[model samples]
Target chain A: MDTILFLFSLFVLALFLGVELITKVPPTLHTPLMAGANAISGITIVGAILAAGADTSSTLVHALGFIAVTMATLNVVGGYLVTNRMLAMFKRKS
Target chain B: MNITIVNLAYLLAAVLFILGIKGLTRPKTAVRGNMLSATGMLIAVVVTLLDRSILTYDFIVAGLVVGGVIGAVMALKVKMTAMPQMVALLNGSGGGASLGLAAASYLQSLERADFGTGAIAVLAVFFVAVTVIIGAVTLTGSLVAFAKLQEIIPGKPLGFAGMRYLNGVLFLASLAGLAMLIANPGNTPLFWLTVAVAAVLGLTLVLPIGGADMPVVIALLNSYSGIAAAAAGFIMGNTVLIIAGSLVGTSGLILTKIMCVAMNRSLTNVLFGVMGEVG
Candidate 1:
């Protein structure tokens, strides 16, 4: 329980700090920063995957975990790719 | 099982969840919303761990240690440029966790001698299976949105000729899978196939959405995650989880609305809207 609490608080803190940073930082960096945070969220994905294999129930847990894994993976892929693409716009215009 | 204390805990958590969502309505008070929601989650987790059969101490300690360390590191080390990606990933994980819990609860039910042998039991299994499919698809789809935002791959929208037709087919297939599961939930293969189809549908749904509209996608996905959690809570008969998850689900939907305003776009513009305009 404490662990989940901690994780939850951590997420809140990240968002709090995120809003603050976005305000202070220039607009050019917005996409990249968001992408990075999205990647970190993958930790939860890992935890979920592990939980799937935990001692509770196998079939349901495994299935759920598989779904979570799939979702998190897509998030990582899509977020990073988009951030990079946005950053690419900063290249010197001819 | 005396449930007075647990019920009260859930009631309190639900109140906090409501407060948190109210707070999240505006940027100025968003932090308060986050704090309130976090508090609600804390209450929920503690109450869940209080179950007599949980064997709490060791696992609880380990969970805190590992989760705390990673969370701390993430909070301190990650730069702002990566915040959105992080949000996407974290949101994806939350969705996944909810899905996993639902699945675990179902599996436990199936293993029970009383439940593994009847038509009613099959209905229960079907609910669990359908929940898993929706939850899984939501999870994967959110991740894909995250990836598009971060530019790990092309951020350009990917669409095929007859894309709408394809999506339509997938939707129908998902529904069929649901019907099949409900009719014969004991068939594990059928359940698995449903999950697989749902996942592919998730992938398909997000594929054509361009990078520019990802914030909206993220918000929408957050709502989906919350709904999944709520379903899990129902399956497990966990009052706290249900309340907290519903709070998140509703709040996410509201947030998505605000985000659309910020972008000067409508929800329709966000989904099918982005496709009409090319990079």
Candidate 2:
């Protein structure tokens, strides 16, 4: 319970920091920001790694982990590359 | 090789993630910011790989290679105009990953026989349900959003007259399933039922939203993807996941608000009302 509470508090603190960090993004970059942030959402890849590599006999667990890792890798790699591409487009014009 | 060092690395990774998001505030630095975030993710992944609990490497390496190759191809080839749908697809996958992680973790816990009947059990089950439902919703919801944006399906509002009530029933049913799983902890079927209902609720919720409202919906789903990650972190007792996940969660919410204001769309209206129907 202490751990959950501690984590909850951390989540709340990060919430404030999240708002503080992204205050002045140009509207043109909103999509890019969304894209970049979406890539960060691929942080779930850490969880996926844990599940995929967990030493268990259950095929279901392995299958779910494999799918999670695959999907999250797509999310992470595709997301960052796309964001970079979009940002480059905006950068070239200016 | 010790746990403390691993945790310290995670802390450093979390800090990098924060700075990475901070970099997104400016156009000049946005690309660099994205790279920094990626570096942070690299750090996290490296640290996770070092953890003692993980024994098998075959599936992990294989999934990474396959996913990485396909993601690279899609990123290189997709037109800029299609970026939104692309982001939607990625966001959905992230959500799917979290939901998958939650389900797998639950099964692992069952195998370990560690889901005790104490308060810890209650909390663990709560996290599982949260991860499952939120992750499932974000998964299917983002997919529907992608379909609408990609023109694979009609972009118009897809709600029926009873759509609102159906959404309500589905939500309640998911909750009941959660309750049953909590009480009987061993009822895997009930647990799966909860997953299915939550997934259907995702489709139902996003169906009524038209293409015009997609920005808000996408932003909201992005937030949910982060939230699902954070919930998974709670289950795993991992700080880096919590911090990074909530960072995305908050950033996504900020983007959603910014989008609402920019599009001159009321957040609540687009978010709650059936889009094509004007009351």
User: Best lDDT goes to which candidate?
Assistant: 2
Candidate 2 lDDT over B1-279, as tens digits, reads: 589998898898888888888888787788888889989889888888888888999889988998899999999999999989999999999999999999999999999988866988988998899899999999999999999999999888887877878888998999998878888777888889899999999999888888888878898899889989998999888888888899999888888998889987777755553555421
Off by over 4 Å in 2: B277-279
The TM-score measured for candidate 2 stands at: 0.96
User: Could you give the interface RMSD of candidate 2 in angstroms?
Assistant: 1.0
For candidate 2 chain B, the 10 contiguous residues with the lowest summed lDDT are B270-279
Per-residue CA lDDT of model 1 for A1-94, tens digit only, reads 3433443453344334323322232334333333333332222332333334345544444554455444544443343334334344444321
TM-score of chain A of 1: 0.60
Q: Assess each prediction's global lDDT (C-alpha) against the native.
A: 0.55, 0.88
Off by over 4 Å in 1: A1-94, B55-68, B113-123, B269-276
Instruction: Report the C-alpha lDDT of model 1 over B51-99, residue by residue, as the tens digit.
Output: 5545324433444455445444554455656666566666666666555
Best by TM-score: 2
Cα-based TM-score, every candidate = 0.71, 0.96
lDDT of 2 by residue, A2-87 (tens): 77789889989988888788787788888888988899889999989988888899999999989989999999999999999999
